[model samples]
Target chain A: MTERFDFEGNAWVLGDNIALDGELMELKYALARETDPEILRHQIFRGLDPTLAERIRPGDIVVTGRRFAHGNPHIQGLIGLRGAGVGLVCESIHSGSFRCAINAGLPFLPRCPGVTALVKPGDRLRVDFATGALQNVTRGERHQFDPLPAELRRIVSNGGWLPTFRQRLAQQN
Target chain B: MGQTLAQKILSRIVGRSVEIGEIIMPEAELVTVHDWYAANAARALDEVGVTELFDPARVMFTTDHEPVAVSPHAAERQQRVREIAARLGIGHFFDVGRGGQGHVFPVELGYIRPGMYIAGYDTHVTNFGAVGALGIAVLTEVSELMALGSVWQQVPQTVRINLHGQLPAGISIRDVAQKIIGELDPDLIDDAVVEFAGPGLRHIGIDGRFTLVNTPTELGARSAIVEPDEIVRAYLADRVDGPVELPRSDPDAPFRAVIEWDMALMEPQVAAPPRPDRVVGVSQVSGTRIDHAYIGSCASGMIEDMRETARFLKGRVIHPRVRLFVTPATNRVAAQMAEESLTGIIQASGAVLTPPGCGVCAGGRIGPVAPGEVSIGTGTRNDPGRLGAHDAQLYIASPATVAAAAITGEICDPRGLDPDLQPREAAHD
Candidate 1:
């Protein structure tokens, strides 16, 4: 992933079941047609907050409640998130979406206890996806999320599984 | 610690024993591509600067997603996909009409077997677990699987289900799935596997078991599976060569939770629109009216499902207000239903018969639910906007229940139907 391991950004805190499709990204765009991430950028979270696309600048953070990415694993949504340089700090993520995010190289922190409650909308926050250290500059607190497993971190470092896989096969030769 | 079925399967494929919750990479015996991913998977491999498959013979591709190419673009895509498959030396490409439904055909043709670890590009690949084979739904990372020709899976904790009693009339395995799902919330099954065991396995055969394993994802489980026995062995006798290895969990192997189903107390379960987990029995939903009803999909579109649906519509026509769509799960199922005149019965009863292959089940590209319409169908998932118009109210039910709804033009109980069509003999015997 070209994404940095640690980054500081404004938070867009959301509640539980904040979906990747139909909520964060419009379903018609994410699931049905376009695969280009740049086109996807104009649609992310516009369904939830009509002004989201313009407001969600590069290096922004989304701290959502449990079961993030609740619906189908239509993955182009994550592509949009990565395209806009958005980072995520969620209480949890669904399995399919988790895999999609890993492959798309979207930087996210999952299983972050007390993070959603401490962080408020528009609060400034810094997240280290590698170490699971989430710091809320507004509230002046730091919370430890569960760190990525060794294999997960490796995938994240190399811009997701496919690129890492490509590298591995190349090394073998 | 005694390892679970997942642990044991991973152990065999990796040539070493594994324990629960350990992440291990294992080479797959089979990895299939549906039409949805066939063209993309091929392009993705090329994008990553690769031209060769790890072992082409181990890979399979199918044309089930859009079995009948809907548009010129689709037909052209199909042609290009064929060319790509040939270029890659990919083995076992089940072309349109040949593949039937991607999920169901591999079982019928015998590429999936008990104890074999299979991987596919769709989430419903979990359907493979019905026959006791482990199917890992590689949703987005399929490119990784394509490039690597293997997969990494975290051995999930098993949720044990011990079934008892037979499925009562109006209570198909679909209802049993609901009964099991009623107890599980999304959070409970994040990375879990449901393993079915016990004496009740004698009754649920391949068809019922397929319906059983198909819906665990709605509850967030990674996959659901049944243990392989003589029935499974017999089903795969011709398809699988040599004596098959049916791995079993050690008796004392640990499970995260155990659920015992007393099928006698069960009734047809209905999931009202917008969600599959929000379930109720058929009686509670007796009077809910419907505008449309469906009886197919990879979920409930099968030989047994078609046979079960034929009983209610044998001589009775559906209500005039309802538009009934009955699709066979595969070309083979369509052929079987026609041979037995079951297709004739459904058609003569005022239902529009669609050809085999997932018609409206995949987001209504073929026959999406109409806006303001209320419907019931055997296809999985009633998530809002999943079937058709965002406001469409879609109910998910068993094929029998869907047929009953088709008959009355509303969500009526199949149990309230005339007794002759009911499965009283099987339930009471």
Candidate 2:
């Protein structure tokens, strides 16, 4: 299947040190044993910002700074974002968070300088992920980086590694 | 081109010589998860419509975090995890008491072997590095590990840390770990594989090396390893269930950097409140009063640490103002403490010996730090507001240092307390 690397979304801006266990996702839920993806999809970022619970739309983009999702290494929050069709483009990310975003099939740009400066909480961004081109229509700024390789593009296209891995297992069998 | 230990292991796993910066696929000999992620991992498997795992026997599930299942929610979570493990036909499931901390339990139970590749869900999975396994904390990506049975990898640039000399009286690996945190905080450590070597490494044992492994994960290390030697061979000769293989870095291996330290120069150290990396010599922070003295957590809750705490507090009672909490890391260790009478001596010194679990060190699930309270803890991290109360202050130190602080109701140097507890042999780092 050919993957769609281009996306148009409304950007949501957050700051650095958004903890993986608590702020991005509730540790209590991981502790409380809440695993149903639907319940989790709505609860994402509720603790970070109450409006995030309701304001998030399908295919929205997230903009944040270094150490984004820094603490505790829980990825249920990323799962929620993937379920909601979100894209993450940040100044930098905790390596753990970077892997989770890719694994969860939430297309991400791991490092983008001046991301927060160029986009606000609700700005339209026409992103050509194939070329790493990001256009912030509101501020009239253009940003880009090196795009992912073909192998990674295939993994992301399959909605992260798990599905692709399952297909390989089936194919081999 | 000489290969670092990490490169050697990855090369073996990938069936080819691997280079730094290359992305490769390497399947772990095993993938592990604790109670927090087990049930969720099961649900995710069902969500993806996959019933068969890549290999069921290789997946391990254990319970360590909040083992008591104190709340109804916690109990329910544990129950769900067990049910899912059964449904998945997982061969290695350690429920409640059977498994302590997944990281150390694997080492103690002989599940981890030298040069083996292991992926785990929790951060402290780095603990397996004590036994010379390439145990990486897959964290959020464990879901994929569960489904794919493979871990994605970037062949990390490795830095060798050469430890030299003796750990002088009153010094321990906790101080060494804190020092690594402070010094290895730069880009040199982030995403880099760390290997500990040098003559002083022979002084440390498996349990002591656990302290060093615990510190590197806090710094974003892929793995913190000490190549297994005679000390490890002797430790594993009778303990491991299967044959073991030892992999080492070549004598002239290419390295990102090599760090050398003399242990004799280290004094009793304390990590100042609010962050584990903000370290200072114990004397600099001595006399600062504390309300709580906690001696447990995956980082320092091993028998070695508890024995040191017991030996130091044998004849003396802690200050009346101090509420000292001593929780064992594992039930086996708790039983061993009983057999050795370490529990009796420690509790007699006014410290409460609770059941084995990760408590305040995890977040006040058991003995919480009250708001406005100042505490000295031996947990892995002391991030602000982590231990229940955001307003409370927590200083990180070794168990022996904590025992000293408990006696004085204030931060004090363990070196000055008593010459009675002479330092013993250490483990590999």
Candidate 3:
């Protein structure tokens, strides 16, 4: 189901997995294996574990490694995760990810340094999109970050353009 | 008190005593639409009971994103867009391959002009800034503005990036561009306008300038512009109604921030691994084998790209294992390359040249990375799930670098190749 983001104590370890927890079962697969030389050098970004999608839910955050936006900023990656109902929290962002998040209105939480070490695989982490903080229940650590300004936060939270547009329209009339 | 081009344009358009960082909302003169979102916006019009919101004459529409309706599901989506455009009274609808990408065709058709504020749903819509227009990417709030006939925007503070020194041999506009983005934090410039200036500005081509303006969305900048010069005038001369002079910034203009770069010392660089800003010289990542090397996209496909590809691949064949694809940004680019026999050199060297239409650059179609495979391309935006697989990697580079990578199956420097083969002349304007 769906869960609104709530801040909790930080005690989790982070690893890139493409699993989502929700009514819609989703799993992201790697295009190339990590061991392959071709995959190692030219593959988009290695920190992304495609399998993280299998267990993620609406409010859970994705804590990834450096260069989170390493490949093309295909809407499918963020859109698929969003469709499966998960909010993203990454350590760093790339130009392509920045474009995808803004254009499609996806909310991406960036600049959470050492976030991966603070959370574990399959760890239920709490993050507040409003204030830009992460809490790990398992590790008992708290990560702080700068929040998105109201306008940008509005675009990301409404699940990108469509919902954002709908919300803005409601406000006008 | 340095001023940016966006600041100058906003000042002229809004004509208010605006302070730095105060949002200045201007009346947009021309708004464009594609069958995808524009049609969606049109439907919203009917839902809101306001169908005649936008002037049909000023509004334009095109269908590029979903071409030929590969799947039945896709076909249905296309039908919906067409119905919306037809019902909303939009006149300029472009079919697959008929109209070029919205950004290129609008300027070609003389719809976009200098000193005008233009908005489109697509991010690359910023490409129009090359023609000296204040082109900004609009979100749904903007869609509401278009349907209701207005958009709200704060006049953002302006940032002037003084670009000086000629780009050195073996380096390209793309390399310099990535360096700039790498230098800035994405959050620092959100909702701001970025303008490029300085004497070295003359060395950049219009296509290259478009690359910089195009990705402002990534930098969190509200809009971006390059002060128009001979390069812009020459490009716009034949297309405009009269002798169109380029716009320049006032010497005494005010700016919120100013940064400078020495283009000469910049080397052939790559946005390595995961982030566009995680940039490093090709030497650092050299010998990193590549599985696929591609050249051509709206960002890098130009006459210069083809010439570079041919020059690099003249006597060399692509690495046996690395698959290569090249799609010219426009038919004009493709046709010119074919006429010059550059296409022959590219194909004979084992590279596949595909038809235009943003082919693989846009996801869900061609050139996506297969799981863990690595492919270096000239296209912009190397995010996860690009090139087909989330784990797939994409490296950004110039056309020459892309071609050289194809030959060696690694991220090799283009300058390291044969110096005897002269690169093609850079396009003026």
Candidate 4:
């Protein structure tokens, strides 16, 4: 399978300290241990923007400020975003959320400092998650940030930790 | 190029020197899962087509949560957990009533030691830091470790917190920990391992250090540890059979930041609802009425905390309006309380004694606060719906403050209570 490193989409700008449990996704869904992306996608961002889930298109990018997905590193939010075919570029993220993003197979740029100032909501943005090159197609601006480390990118590219674990098991067999 | 405690520990695990921000897959020395998550881990293992663990001997399972089968459904879950443990060939299986809290008993039983890299399914596994072991909370990722024998981890920088002076009367380490987390900038501690140092280490015992290490993850810290010294050595001497190695950082170790705090100036602290970091001095929220009071969890259910609560409630009775529940973190702690006669004093003071386990702090599974009620206790978190009802309010503090609240039926400073006051009847307002 080929790993696509580039992503293009419209930006969905969010502020700092967007919590995982109460804000990005509700606590009930996570507590229910619901992993079905179709069900989760409808509930994503319902706390912050009720209509945003319906408006999100495939390949849409979420641009967030520092401390994205700050509280309780539940991966339902990341799974929902990935299910919707959206990518994320945050100014910064907690270590637990960073691990969840990789494990959920969500394409993310976790350390794009000052990224919120680079693009406006609804702007067309193109990102190379492998090379850390972010292009603001709407404004024709270019920016650079550190890419995911090779060790972690491999897990995301393999469609999360489970698939990677399966592959490792197969190799062992 | 001196290495912090975190760097040194990770380097030893991987058999090579590691740098901060570098990802490494080092085999864990010990891994633990409690009853609450054991089923989830079993299901994940089945989904991954794993029939056996990479090394079953290294894995442990304990029935710390729901220890007494609160309901028929809980009974069924416990039965299934036993079956799963048997099926998986887990080496160390502490069934209900055997191990108290998975975090606390491991140290008591000497399963945890200095310079060890361990993993657990629960966040408060940071309690192992009391003995100088780096216990990282892997959440549901424990399944990956069980199957593959290792999981990826990025080395984190270390933050040095230096404490000085001695704590004034009635100020427990929990208060000091709450204040430290409230004041430390989240950015500096985020994704960093906090290393507790300075002269204050001599003043705090193992149980107090557990409270200090257990609270930092709420602020996004990767993990926390204390530099193992004679205190740790003395505590582990009788518990461990083999030679124990105590790890410390180099004098010039590179720390992201250093924070110095004087315990003499510290005051009793209360973490208000909505978040654990919303800490304020006790004077700020005194006299607020409460419906319930709890004093247990991995955070404060140790023997020392029990002694402190007993000391305050010796001859006093709790307010009639408040339902105070005292839970020991482990059965051993309960036994100690009974042997020392603290249990009778606590129960005689009108405080109900629950079974030794996670108690109400485990999502209020055992003792829950009803709607429109307020509670004060030593639980780790006070998030909405944390203790029972979504509308219920929980204020967290040290055991002494909680005892004071139980007596007055409201939040009050423990220091303000008269030590010589006589036992009185339940207050009727």
Candidate 4 whole-model C-alpha lDDT, 0 to 1:
0.89
DockQ of candidate 2 (2 decimals) = 0.20
In model 2, which residue pairs have backbone atoms overlapping below 3 Å? B203-B426, B204-B426, B204-B427, B204-B428, B205-B426, B205-B427, B205-B428
Q: Candidate 3 regions off by >4 Å?
A: A1-173, B1-4, B15-17, B34-36, B66-68, B418-429
lDDT per residue for candidate 4 within B1-429, as digits (tens), equals 798988889999999999888999988899999999898899999997899998999999988878889799899989889999999999899998897888899999989999999998998888899999998889877998888788899988999988898788667899999998888888788888999999989999999998999999889898999989899999999999988888888888888988888877456999999789999999999989999999999999999999989988887889999999898988889999999999999999999898887889999898899999999989999998998999998899999899999998889878766363322322211
TM-score of chain B of 1: 0.95
Cα miss at A122, model 3 (Å)? Answer: 26
Q: Candidate 1, overall lDDT?
A: 0.81
Q: What pairs collide in candidate 4? A: none
Best by TM-score: 4
lDDT of 4 at A128: 93
Query: For candidate 2, what is the total of clashing residue pairs?
Result: 7
Lowest lDDT 10-residue stretch of candidate 1 chain B = B420-429
Mind giving the per-residue lDDT tens digits that candidate 2 earns over A67-159?
A: 778765556788787767677788777766667677666677776766777888889988876678999887888887666555666678887
DockQ, each predicted model = 0.56, 0.20, 0.10, 0.75
Off by over 4 Å in 2: A1-69, A74-92, A104-149, A159-173, B241-243, B421-429
Tens-digit lDDT track for model 2 on B365-385? Answer: 777888999999898888777
**3 or 4, greater by lDDT:** 4
Question: On a 0 to 100 scale, what is the lDDT of residue A23 in model 4?
Answer: 85
Model 1, which residues run further than 4 Å from truth? A8-12, A32-44, A51-61, A84-86, A118-126, A135-143, B365-368, B388-390, B421-429
Per-residue accuracy of model 4 over A69-149 as CA lDDT, tens digit each: 888888899899888888899999877888888988888999988889989999999999998999999999999999999
RMSD of each: 3.5, 5.3, 8.6, 2.3
